[model samples]
Target: MSDLTDLLTVPVLDRSLQGALKAALNGKAKPPGALGRVEELALRLGLIQGRLIPSAARPVLLVFAGDHGLTRSGVAAFPSGVTVAMVDTLLAGRASANAFARVVGAEVRVIDAGVAADLSGRTGLVQAKVAPGTEDASVEPAMTLAQAEIALLAGARVADEAIADGANLIALGEMGIGNSASAALLMHRLAPAPLGDCVGEGAGHSPEGMARKRAVLAQAAARSVATAPLEVLTQFGGYEIAMMAGALLAAARAGVPVLVDGFIGTAAALLAVRLAPNARDYCLFAHASAEAGHRLMLEVLEARPLLQLDMRLGEGTGALLAVPLVQVACALLSEVAELADVLEAAG
Candidate 1:
């Protein structure tokens, strides 16, 4: 896999960008700006882009789909086939992510990163297959180092193409069965917390299923720690997780704003941050997910998400929901008239 450090470089928000936004906001007809968080988001975005004017034109939603090896252990409530089914749903524009992206007017692209099943002749899909499936992490490493690298590169390439397509802002989402287990494993590796704390009831898992998921994650983590290095993400991480890391890194290097989704996406963000410390500057945590580990991951990154709707859906729904808020911020900063522009009444 490409060294995340080599693949991504973080962009710092320029002080001048903030100054421009503050000036724009203060100049608005309203008293020193009462636009609230919208104004704040715009200013932050301006700073993120180092421009007094930030454009969110051609926003692209990249939805990466894959299957996790741990699914074979029956750790999730949904069957492993759900991974392929959901990917097909996404490609058919019938999934939640698809609907959300459509509502937000963002173009959506689905990437089949490493689904275990064959999806031949799928229309409107980006065929970036890395492997047939990951190894069963409970028994051994989920994937080889080479497979992990391919997944990352696939994500990076998608981001590059999106940028070329004129997308200045990017949002990430994913579809994968048993991905929660992979996410939990990555969280444990990155944060070194208790397995139970890292685990969550994914895809409507029952309490019993949740327990089994946690046990599987614990076992996978133990095996990975004993045999794999920190870079060996394939041991316990999902292909989607690795690809999301790659896309984030690619976005960082391209100097574009990246809005991250929930727990699985957060795990990928954590990996990206670990590989490239500077990447954090370009990233915006879209929301605080309901997943227990998401908060810990956000805390580790010292990130402040824009929303906290108890959202647990993994289809970038949270990020898409935050889009209007960002747009409003820009509008207020750029369109609102300043107090100075107002005329005093003639006595």
Candidate 2:
């Protein structure tokens, strides 16, 4: 990787269309501001596309899967093998995300960011593993700087390819059994919050399991005082989380709207924003996660999510649920008649 830091560049969204887009939205054949956040989303899409008419017709969900060695420390209710299994389920189009994507008319692609198992023979899986899996962060750094760079660059490349293939809307989600623990650690250090606040009951962990997860995360936090974005990611993030951050940056660079999923995804967004503040401009938070510390994460990013279904599933399911809403927001902005036009037609 030749100075992969340059790949993190994300140009701020162009604001030239903001005024006209707002006017057009206000002029739509409805009560002014009647659509609530839908209208706001329309304006955001217009500004992102730099046009009065934005498009969400080609939405693609990139689900990155990885494994974390921290599972060995009893941080999750499920085994790390679940990550590989879920990757297979996603590729087979049997996951909840796939079902939701089918209903919303979006494409799904599964990327093997760093699953511990060999997924070589899996059909329709994007092969971008930087390592089998990350090392246990509660003991040592999750991954070396080079591996983190590779994972981030791989994510960017995957996102760039999706955009090149005409993905107007990019939705990001991740699969890793121990990843919520990893996310909590990332948020604990990067958001500079109390570790207890960041830790949550991932996958319905028992009380004992939750306590163990918290203890392991506390250990990880005590081991690292690194607050820099990349350093924190290198210290505690999973491969899929880094890839999601990479993809977020890539979407911002391409000026595409990004629907960030739940807590894990938000943690990645936080990391991405820390890397490039302007990247936050292109992000549309899909939903507020029910997971612990998610609200704090959103607050730190100053983000208002599009939905609040009390959801904690992390496979881009929440994002897929918000896809049709984005489409409708774009459609209303582009296809709705102006109030003046409607009045003149009546005459």
Candidate 3:
């Protein structure tokens, strides 16, 4: 057994401050819960931070980039090389995630979890490649169990480093061709949903292409009966997915809140929550992805996403878009005056 599993124990959030946090939010100048989900957000942040006052200072978005050998099995519409291209775009600060990070005052770092091409020596990218890319799951396990363990540990360390660098909040994203296929497979086995329900037109596919994708995924499913979290990950998960799962576990262990992006990110969260249920307490769903099976995945996780712009693009773009809301939620709790104070001042 890998030591990574032993290190994944996430203690439940200390809810001892829940009542006081709720009281503080209720006593804010506006009517109780007027901020709607924003109030809920503040409460969650307060609970995670263990104080009435919470902070979103130094928000960091870690975009894990990898490639999937499943692409060779005709599972994706784009070539695997796009993963490397997008990594370049992100490192050049020209990706959608980077642009959103700039507007919301967050930092973006791309991690090369398992891109097929050699990406070492990149100035801004973090090096944590588990393999060039996973093997085709339609033919064999996506990666060895050992490789999966390494990827999980790599993700945990990446997140820990961000927290050490003053990141009060972590927003997760991913860049990988055919990862939606990997996510769909992970969801199929872990969510235990029907394979058809988990399959979607990832990156846009034609009718024949979609059929081919479904067939390929069915083949992958038939190849394995492993439903355990780590087993499922080894059987079907991409390195980026495994790493995101690790990042979530590490963030929960550190008591830092995480902004989970769309379908792929949620799949990673599902794997993490399965490994350590307490990790769910630290995850805030960023948006409802337009992918076919995402709603069901969110249902299984019992998460309410903050936004739903029909977004399915991966790259932590949705997570970065939610950063301002998190900051506002923190500010409302830490800076807004109480109703009693307002009444006293008026009197």
Candidate 4:
């Protein structure tokens, strides 16, 4: 029953095993620094696990879907209905995230946190609805403080369930239509960056549409009374983003590294880091998204994502694609032989 502030107090990753892991990596059959970042990735895994040879199995990608009232306005190019449709696509294994998850042998779990439409009784969907959808932030606060807390807690619970189900790695993503607008606002607020820099043609908004989007977001930001991170999240962020922020903290608390997805996911990570600064240690940015705001958000987080595929898809596809890279890093630590061991075997 701990609150967000209490949850933020999760212990930092233990670094006592770093020396042993580094020694083991250096002693590997490969030449020094030959594996490059993979070796560094291996060391990070060990630090998170407090082990010299960390391992990962049952990687899971949790995609949280919601809707924004702004979609009903003219901020985005696509209709809000596309959010629910994409969720269906995700559930049917036809979406890009599904395809990537299959390739990585990772399980995909979708959550209905705040879709505008009813998605209950859907097979393979976790029902943790915070609301039908958030209120239009351009006119008012998107969600109440209590509802925001609920979304955050729901995210933490979903993450707890994933870990309990034996997932050692979790990749977080979102699917709220007009959410890039939401993410843009959150980035502007949290990164304290230029509004113009944060605005993007999410869902392929045309020049005119992008300009309209910018205007709508500007109005929303002026109305935003979100001074604190939680306030910013509650007033301007969607349920998916709030939940992912909570999920990021929970995953880090469990000492599991989160493969944070694109712009939307990075916004959540930014809020999580703002609330719990140590949470950054538990996240691996999945990619540098093509979204205009994502690079600045990633820069704010000081993250070097595993890939730069120029991906902007928000269904956790980018994160899922980076899964094998992390798994391979863990595998290398466990399977690669020490040069001394190799020499002894040769003798």
Q: Which candidate, 2 or 4, would have the higher TM-score against the true structure?
A: 2
How many residue pairs clash per model? 5, 0, 0, 0
Taken over the whole model, the C-alpha lDDT of each candidate is 0.81, 0.92, 0.92, 0.88
Lowest lDDT block of 10, candidate 2: 1-10
- Best-fitting candidate, measured by lDDT? 3
Clashing pairs in 3: none
Stretches of model 1 off by over 4 angstroms after superposition: 1-5, 11-13, 226-232, 343-347
lDDT of 4 at 45: 85
lDDT of 1 by residue, 1-347 (tens): 25644675555445665666787777777866476767777777787766777878678889988888788888788887888888888888898888888888889998888888888799998988888768899999888878877788889989989998899889999988888888888888776567778888877787788778878777777775632323558678888888888999898888788999999998888888777778888888899999878898898899989999999989888888877767777667566655665744322
lDDT of 1: 0.81
lDDT of 4 by residue, 126-239 (tens): 999989989999998899999989998899999999999998898998887899999999999899898899998777978889889989999999886576898998789899
What's the TM for model 1? Answer: 0.93
